[model samples]
Target: MEGRLENGQYWQGWTVEAPVGVVVFVHGVHEHGGRYAPVAARLGEAGYACYAVDHPGHGRSPGNRGNIDGMDTTVAGVAALVTMAADRHPDVPVFVYGHSLGGLVALTYLTGERHPRVVGAVISAPALDTSASNAVQRAFAPVLSRFLPDLGVLALDIEAVSRDPEVVAAYRADPLNHTGKIVARTGAEILTAATAMPARLRGLTLPLLLVHGGADRLMPVSATEVVRAHAASPDLTVRVFDGLYHEPHNEPEKAEVLTEIVAWLDAHLPPAPA
Candidate 1:
């Protein structure tokens, strides 16, 4: 249910008996890991256990909301959770799934050195590049990070999160869904990581699936294209949902998206015991 990492980060997860596989999920910025309960339930029904950790400054974890010293902290946090999952279910294959900002962290974890091994990965609408509208902030981010690292930069426009009005309302009402400004340091780190992602992706050799909404206003489909083109993974698959917004998991076509994910994961499943 709930636990604290030795690093003092708060983590939450759900599991099923005799799971066929495991998935370590990482949530996006300004949102806690708990929002994926429904998605986890679907995966659980398919015989996959799901574990997720709230990033340092987000969710139930303690830190300045929307602030992190660097992306390494987030990457390390996900690696820890993967290790925990492996310890608990050594026989089951573990897959990492990340949405939006979490997707960037997941990719980083896979591409980074000295990280835990996973069977495959799912990246959904990763924030690989700064939105065109935020170009000014991206330009000034470095200077601001040095002087006002904690300074609030931009507020997420909730409407851009999903096409469903109900989902929008719930996100707006969710207390854990942070509505604060993105810190200067966090912005800079994200921009830096995104800039470096193309080269980093060229070295990723694991089974991978990249999903994105063609209509997503935040992270454009072109970002996913870059990842697909550069990722050296022999089994990389890219799916672009034409009309959906940012969160396909919350969109009206979510069932289709989930089906696609389950199918990909199942194809890569470790062989059944005799």
Candidate 2:
């Protein structure tokens, strides 16, 4: 259930013996992969195994909280998980699902030079062209990153997470839910990745399902539109929930979102050979 990456990062995950397929999940910033247990459970009941890993500096993994040295490291970490899943489920296809910051990592992994083979990807509220910080903080981010990489910049807005009041309350009460400020370097990296993501989308040929909340203030629906426009994949699909917030999977209409994901996976990935 728990192990360490070759790079020494700790990871927690689960797998099934004979699954129709597997979903490798990459969670949002300031949150560990464990939060997806419910999502994983739902997928598991559908005959799909699931795997997730805490990003460095978040969850139970070891690192300076809320800080990442570079996006490459994060991409590599996710790629490693993909490899692990593929190795364990060689007969079954694997699909990647990323939310928020993890969505950025998933996108990067799918488009990057070195990446594991996967059937498709599901991105939810990807942080492609947005940062949590305000204009003032954005303007001075580079200088702050160089001088004080660890300096705390922006506090996460809990209210922006989901439409469900209970989900918001649970997030606030969860000890693993990082409520801390974003570090200067982390903010800088996020901005850098967001700015560079569009050009990268042109190279992504993998089947993709990009989902976002039309009312998501954290990462707007417009960002997902940009990705859809440039993505080279002919199989790309986009779904914008009219009144949902950042976390549609945690919203009141979560069943619809989850069902959409499952249906997409079922359509794309055929059953493994006998």
lDDT leader: 1
What stretches of model 1 exceed 4 Å from their correct place? Answer: 114-117, 131-136
Tens-digit lDDT string for candidate 1 (139-183):
898999899998987767789889999999999899887888778
> What global local distance difference test value does model 1 have?
0.87
Compared with the true structure, model 1 gives a TM-score of 0.95
What's the CA error at residue 184 for candidate 1, in Å? 0.9
C-alpha root-mean-square deviation, each candidate:
1.5, 1.8
List, residue by residue over 134-182, the lDDT tens digit for candidate 2: 7887799899988998888877788999988998998889887778888
Residue pairs clashing, model 1: none
Superposition TM-score, candidate 2 onto the true structure: 0.94
